[model samples]
Target: MSKKLSFTVKLLGVAGGVFLAAFLSLLAAWFYVQNWLKTPLQISDAGYVYELKQGQSLGYLANDMGVAGVLNHPRLLRLYARLNDANKVHAGEYFFPQGTTPESLLQKLIKGDVILYQVTFVEGWTVKQALAALEKMDSIEHLLAGKSSADQLALLALPVKDLEGWIFPDTYSFSRNTSDVEIVQNAYRKMQTLLETEWEKRAPNLPYKNTYEALIMASIVERETGHHSERDQIAGVFVRRLQQGMKLQTDPTVIYGMGDNYKGRITRKNLEEPTAYNTYVIPGLPPTPISLPSAASIKAALNPAPGRALYFVAKGDGTSEFSDTLDAHNQAVRRYQLNRRSDYRAAPPSAVGN
Candidate 1:
């Protein structure tokens, strides 16, 4: 072969070799990136919580995680995210478990799977108790803090001054930085909706002049007993009392009226001292709800059981004994209240579920 031709062939071979090496390098990089994307994060057993602020991009998350040493090669993850059209990430708190991979993390953000904090308003809980519970949730932004109940009521824009039974007793889940007012509003809306719906299906001859009156009665029933089986019976007793123009004489109302003064037990004088919430002194239902009522209690109030029961006494075993006459109630009170057992509980240990 000619020298010039041989030189040209060598040059071509060198170029081809360079091109092959480049191809192999690119292929290796591609595989490395794929592996990196699927690799589990280097978070501790306790895991890591990341709060993505509003309007933050996926690239920000990648760089942030890389800086935190949760994963190496955040650039590759960012590239993967960009290529997959997953640059949009929702803002919220996210928990990164030990075995979470880049792909899964990205998916979680894309799907807006944020950490949810729950606040529960228990049945028979007073508004004060509910607000206290709400304030304890660190994730919620407290707008009601350092404010009077009246001020908080105004802030919430509620029609009534007293929240009382206005909020539904249930577990409410919210994302991070959720405002306290928002949560209370949600609970209020839920309660209003539920009450309206239940009010529509109320049993005939119900003595409630309006839904609000029924709500007060429901709150009374909620505080009277926690037994799901006895809710209707308890409601029936109170309903009959109202219909017969008799006094409710429930202790919970008196305790509510006592407010911060109540140590643990009620006294005869406490019952006699008339307060707006004391059903013992009030001829009919209390001026407002004394506690948050459960949906079951509301249902019971609207649809009282068919019975002649006019009174009930707590059996001290998370249940109540109902009677058609005052004498039976008095007997039950003596048996259960006078000689109460050491393990006596007016309500069950768990009084949440139906």
Candidate 2:
């Protein structure tokens, strides 16, 4: 062959070899990226928490994760995200478990699956107790902090001086940095809706003149009940008392009236002193609900148990002995309160809200 022709063929061979090597490198990179997407993240066994700020891009998250040592190849992850059109990730705190793959993690971000924290308002808890609990939660923004009851009420725009039993007792879930006021509002709205619904279905001839009075009765029933089975029975006793113009004379009312003075027990003076919340001293139901009543208590107040029970006494075993008359109640009191057992307790362990 001619020398110039031989040189041209050698040049063509070199070009082909370089092109093949480039193609093989790209193919290998594609396979590696695919494997990376399916591989588990380098998070602790417990998990890792990452908070994606609002308006942040997926590339920023990848770079941040790379800096945090949780991601091996952030650039590759970013490229994968770009190719898959997964850049529009929602902003929130996310928990990545140990076995979480990049594919699952990205899906979670895209689906806005943020970590939810719970704030529980236990049954029979006072408004003060609920506020105290809200204050302690780190995730909740303390909007009520340094704000007086009146200020807080004004902030909520509620038409009441005292929240008291207006806030429903239940577990509420919220995302991070959620305002405390929002939590309170959620609970209040829930209670309002539930109370309205139950009020409409209330049993006939209830002594309550309005839904608010029924709420007061429900709060008393919530505080009095030690067992779930006895909620309606406890409600029945108070209902009969109200219908007969008799004082409720419940210990929880006296304890609530006593406030800071209450030392885990009630006294005759505490019961006799006239306070707005003391059902023993008040003519009828208290001015407002003394504690946070549960849905069950609310239901029981509106539709009390079908009986003529007028009184009840704690039986020292997380239960009560209900009586239809004062004489039976006195006998039960003598048996359960006077001749108390070694393990005497006014309420159940689970009924600590009382």
Candidate 3:
């Protein structure tokens, strides 16, 4: 009877040990699953959305993130972000949910969702005109106010004395709350990138002193022709004149010097007037670019077509004829300008001339 009692006690001890081990294993598995659920997962949903304003506090962000299902606990999210030193969140529209883990929310906040605002700078716009257009943008105007033109130039990281030629003509997308400095910097950076690539493969014997000079010439080319097919030919004529040490004698340069208050027509006296940007007076490139040039015009300036053409004149139609000799140019001008007075009738009433 004593042996049987001892055996029963040992059996009960073994059973208790086995149950305890099983309970421990189950607890470990449950802990692992909890951790796995909290881990950041790249999930998307149509209902998730959030907005982060400039200077929004961490508490406010936490509340919004919680409502949007981006965080399980607002307090936890704030604590985690603060503990990890993740407080520098830029202003923009964000889309997320409370189901999003703390790690994922932190990552999204760090990588700001910059809302792209499309700004189109048309070809042939002078710096003043460009600035006027920019001023119409409330955000840009707000940033530019109280800032001098010199300050603006500095913001763009331009080596030049002004930002006249640096703002590249293109359709750019910027954040709605983007500062004027950032907008200008983006344009200048793009211009620099384009110039670097084009300058490396520029045509042989081009007379430009540097990429800026090429840009200046390209602005003239852009203003000269609205026809896409005529850019190369017009570029060729200007390039030839430059190589021959002749004046550019472009009418657009004269118009540009007149400023925004310029009257309807460019008179003969306007061409002779001396100004820093007057191509008619200056033998080489103007002191600065007259207008914003398109990418096509820049390409034309870099790789002008091979030709002996020195002169060109608008043929009343949407195109111009090129000439190798002054006599040919004179004849073409007489035919296009003298006899084509009716063709150059006043611009249509509905048409707004730039």
Candidate number with the higher lDDT (2 or 3): 2
The clash count for each model shown is: 0, 0, 7
- Give per-residue CA lDDT, model 1, range 1-354, as digits (tens): 999999999999999999999999999988987787788999899998999998888788888898999978888878887887878889999998889998889889988899999998899898888999987878889999889988998899988767889989999999999999999999999999999999999999999999999999898888777478888888888888789898777777777888899887665566668788666677888789988999999999999998897766667677777777656766666677663423222221121111
Candidate 2 lDDT trough over 10 residues, lowest sum: 345-354
Models ranked on lDDT: 2, 1, 3
Candidate 2 lands at a TM-score of: 0.83
Cα deviation at 204, candidate 1, in Å, is: 0.8
**Predictions in order: lDDT:** 0.82, 0.83, 0.72
Candidate 2 residue 218 Cα shift, in angstroms, is: 0.7
Candidate 3 Cα outliers beyond 4 Å, as residue runs: 1-50, 53-59, 64-91, 95-111, 139-141, 146-148, 155-157, 339-354
Best by lDDT: 2
Angstrom error of the Cα, residue 113, model 2: value is 2.3
**What lDDT does model 3 reach?**
0.72
